[model samples]
Target: MKELNFFKCKQVIENNNIHIWLINLEIYKKEINNLKAILNSDELSKSEAFYYRSDQERFIVGRAILRIVLSYYLDILPKDIVFYYNHYGKPYILTNTIDSLEFNITHSNEMLAIAIANRSVGIDIEYMYCGRNLEEYMESLFTTYLQKDLRMNTSEEKQKILLRLWTVLESYVKATGKGIRYPLSTDIRNIVNQHTKNLINSNFEISIDTCFLFKKIEIKDYICTCCILEPLDKFIIFRDEFILELPYYFEKIVR
Candidate 1:
């Protein structure tokens, strides 16, 4: 997999653009104390509620990293950021200080991905080589989708196609704030299948109606996908590397 470089400074988000942070949680282990301290009471309590120590640590680091990242953007203290969740359990910033700051988070195996944008955004990252029998597992989960989308591929190719489809479905539902509740089989079959066919291009991006746009990203050994609730031409996307050190070292922009 291509590892994202973590520098020493914080990143700034621009208007009409999406900024993605690819964080490796392992690097934040030593800063557990600092990160934990930055979590608000509710967040801290949620972290403590995790049954496993590792889970608790991941939650703390993830939430804390979110706070620190948002702080850099909003220019507020990390501990001051408040969050509210929608009915589908999508978290949103609750403060009045920043307007239209929307984001989504997804983590897998030690890698955490965050998408920040002015409009609604969703991201999903999955370990491509996870030990699970993807062929069998995906067949069971996405039987109808596979039948419609992967009619021509070999069994091996089908697995790769299936993973891409899964990420697309996941990120789409998440971006719409419906989560998995949106019946994958009935609700989005037409739009999903169309995007699946479009993924044949090396760089594929399409708007499902005027409300949402879906795109697949090429990250080694990982199926990373993103959805933005706007037409593709309306916004720009910036992929920023993670910074491990707890704050301060703003340098030149990567652009």
Candidate 2:
């Protein structure tokens, strides 16, 4: 929480540099009232439309937190920021303050993940749920090749592979802002190959690179991933709570 102050106004987010902010939705629950005050009328109406009390509160908190976080980068009041969504329903900053500001948001249960970068970026976080019919559910969403690979793996291994594959595919479509328009039937196995990672270059067409590029984020009890248009030159994850800290930094950011 204290560290968020150290984040200077408008840090130059480079084209290939991406920063991921992970927020635990529960932490902001206590401030729900204050959070709601920051939301605009449209957001408020959207929150009101939610049938469940918990869902409504979460919606309010998430939108308010997004505005607060973006304010630091845009150097504007949180309430003043506005968003415009594309044809596919992906949101982007509408301000002329900076043309490069692009972001994507995702949440699962109590976890909220946001990715911001100079270039187009997308992120997804999913709770790891290994249900009894996990394979059956995955079969409908995955290509035949991925399904075959999953079938050959043991239960534990299958869960791990299924998590990565599913999340990466999600992140890819989100990055493109194509949403469900992009076929789920893509054989993404070849793009995620280990050998390709060592050979990936920054300069490439959108077609081939989009198929091959995605970063997997390791969060306990969850599967997370991010995708960017170009090769990810720099990647940083800032969490509201101290959770998975490893080869990455151990400190928390954006309370």
Candidate 3:
């Protein structure tokens, strides 16, 4: 994993065609001020600026991590990377460069992660103890088959397993840039298998070429998944170490 010094922050990882940027939100003091400047700028509408600024600190961390990771692939300044929202409201790259780097950003609690790859890629991370009744939430958010699978795997050993599945599904939807347009009620196994096969057969098609590779990573207490439209021989997972620095910042800022 390659660590970058861009933006004066540490703990950025890059391998093969993939880049993962992580940030522990607790450590950054200047982030809030920086985000406020962006929000207060005349470039954004009053309502839009106010909405984003309301959660400015979190979004600042997310965008900072995104800028650093993307800088490794694009020559543009981190703040200059223009973004456009898709029909489904997901943000996407709008550069004229031929790099074709696909990426996704996500944040939960104090941990924020971003993934960038040569093909369409999406990633997600959720805290293990987010105060949800797992069984009840699954029944409402997942398909009948998935609910049954969760029920059958009643052993305590499956908490991580359930999270793994959830992350993968979330990642797939994010990669497609569809968000919840493709609901979680769809069969998980079928989606993975079918998407992989479809990508292989339609590699020459423009749409398929936009998203062709997919992967998932599971770390202690965290589950993350990546989806791409291109084929991949193997994936290398790197658990970012920078999250350890966040608590220091949080202690100073939030308190």
What are the models' TM-scores? 0.80, 0.78, 0.65
Residues 30-143, candidate 3: write the lDDT tens digits: 444553343323333433454554355566555655664565457655667776788887877866655466778887767777776666678888777664445554346545
Clashes of each: 0, 0, 10
- What local lDDT score does residue 218 receive in model 3, on the 0 to 100 scale? 43
TM-score attained by model 1: 0.80
- Candidate 2, poorest ten consecutive residues by summed lDDT: 196-205
Query: What lDDT score is found at residue 199 in candidate 1?
Result: 54
Task: Give the distance in Å from residue 200's predicted Cα in candidate 3 to where it truly belongs.
Answer: 24
Instruction: Give lDDT for model 3.
Output: 0.54
Sort the candidates on lDDT, descending order. Answer: 1, 2, 3
**Candidate 3 Cα outliers beyond 4 Å, as residue runs:** 1-16, 34-55, 140-149, 152-159, 182-189, 192-214, 233-255
Better TM-score candidate (1, 2): 1
Q: What are the lDDT scores of the predictions, listed in order? A: 0.70, 0.69, 0.54
In terms of TM-score, which candidate is strongest? 1
Query: lDDT winner among the candidates?
Result: 1
lDDT of 1 by residue, 29-71 (tens): 7778877777788888888888999999999888888877777
User: Per-residue lDDT of 1-255 in model 2, one digit per residue for the tens?
Assistant: 221231243455666778888888888787787777778999999999999999998898888878877876787877788888899889987666776788999988888988889877888887876453455655666456656755786886677565665666678778888884534435444444422222222222233444435666767888787778776667777776432122333334321
